[model samples]
Target: MPAPRMSTEQEIEALDEVCQRLAGFEDAISLEWLDGYLTAIVASPRRIERDEWLAKMGQGVFARAYADPADAEQAIKVIDSRFEVLANQLDPELILDDADVLRLAPLMIELSDDDKKQLVADGHIKEDELHLLEQTGEVWAIGFMDATHDFPNDWPDADLETEEGQLFDECMLRVVSLTMEPAELKEVFDELYDGEELTREELIHEALYAAQDMRLYWLDHAPKPPQRRVGELPGRNDPCPCGSGKKFKKCHGAQMQ
Candidate 1:
């Protein structure tokens, strides 16, 4: 049987423990960033292996490692559970529960009062600039963009020639805009939003809509297996009928013998 779904409170507690454990590592990503990164992996047109994405978790050349091996294993379990939840949410055939929709909501960067004051005092941002910072989803967008950046070959430029492709391109641009520096953001916003800044509510809505569009686009466009005649077995070297991109012999076919 499949694993039981985690309760909302349980999921929160597990993620909190993960964040606390990784807190001491300067290069480790925040929980919000991890959420976005995993969302991108789920929405990817091609399946990214768990180990491959896990290795890319750190900020620079170094990979994030837990001091205790047990902690690492436990953290991976939590992260993998979240990954499965995201993948299920994007499955086109599945009817989402209310809780699933709630889980789909993007995690945004929330600043403590002290963090706000520190930013203001350092002149990194004006006091007023901190308003609605929690709803902007900037860090989440950065993490999403990072995944796309790392796999440029996997995420090719959208075909502007078709309406659906054009819409997909627009959605991608909207998400990428959130990751821009002030000057870059202004340039993109001017073109995409008629030079008006998006409010926090608008940003949140746009990000959610973009993610939905991504799910739909991939469902329609991802590669499919060839049809087979009734009772005809798959060739040993053919792509697995399960759509895993592995040869038949290495996938489900291995179970037959």
Candidate 2:
């Protein structure tokens, strides 16, 4: 038999009908019912954008959208517990939704390549999954899993609504995380940033390292309280690495306590 046609609109219409029926029975559905409804809708064969669907269902029901695929329930618990730590340490604005969190959970947990494969098996990321890193708030690293180049060679000129554009936006976000400023980070990326122009892994590595160094400079030198890591200590033994002639023990070190 021939394969069935995939029509997203039909699936959407069905969901709408179900929602209408539920609304008729009750003015408002509980969060549990809404979640069950969304899960059933996406678990189907229709390829839907997870974020858009969640927004439609109401932000509360879809909040768990970014849970880790390996241990979805546990991941949510851990994230909530750790969210305050992040807010207190780095920019609280770095907060993410369920879909974004899931997309990034593997990286956050520092999973090995083998573990990543297991996550795929666990449905953490789909086999056809593609991602784009935010290089800066304005520039993204767009690419696909089953394709070449991460983003379009001509980016902004490309149709922003197309799959290519969405991929580009995702990549830009990834790059933003790398640069530590989604919207304003400098674009030090070379043409090689696009896989099509150059695929050397070393080049990509060097580019990221350079971007990190820039972020470090901003964090350390900017007048704000440096976002020092927990247990991180500046060299008290050295010449106060902040370029001051005074010993670190006499300068920044004295403030350490």
Top model by TM-score, which number? 1
What lDDT does the true structure give each of the candidates? Answer: 0.71, 0.34
Q: Can you write out model 1's per-residue Cα lDDT over 1-257, one digit (the tens) per residue?
A: 23334326688679767766565574446777777787888888878898787776555322355656777788778877778777766554442223134225655666768988998999989877776464457778777878887767667788899998888888898787776666787876787788998765676667766876787688677644457768777998998889999999999989986
| Quality of model 1 by C-alpha lDDT | 0.71
Identify the candidate with maximal lDDT: 1
- State the lDDT at 111 in candidate 2: 39
Distance from true location, Cα of 82 in model 2, Å: 11
How far does residue 50 in candidate 1 sit from its true spot (Å)? Answer: 1.2
Candidate 2 has a TM-score of 0.20
lDDT of 2 by residue, 1-257 (tens): 11212224444344344434444544343222332233223222232344444344432332444344554444334423332222222221232211122111101112355865786899778756613322221111211110112112212232467764454444433333333332222332323244233222333334333223322232323233337687656677778877889988999899866
TM-score of each: 0.66, 0.20
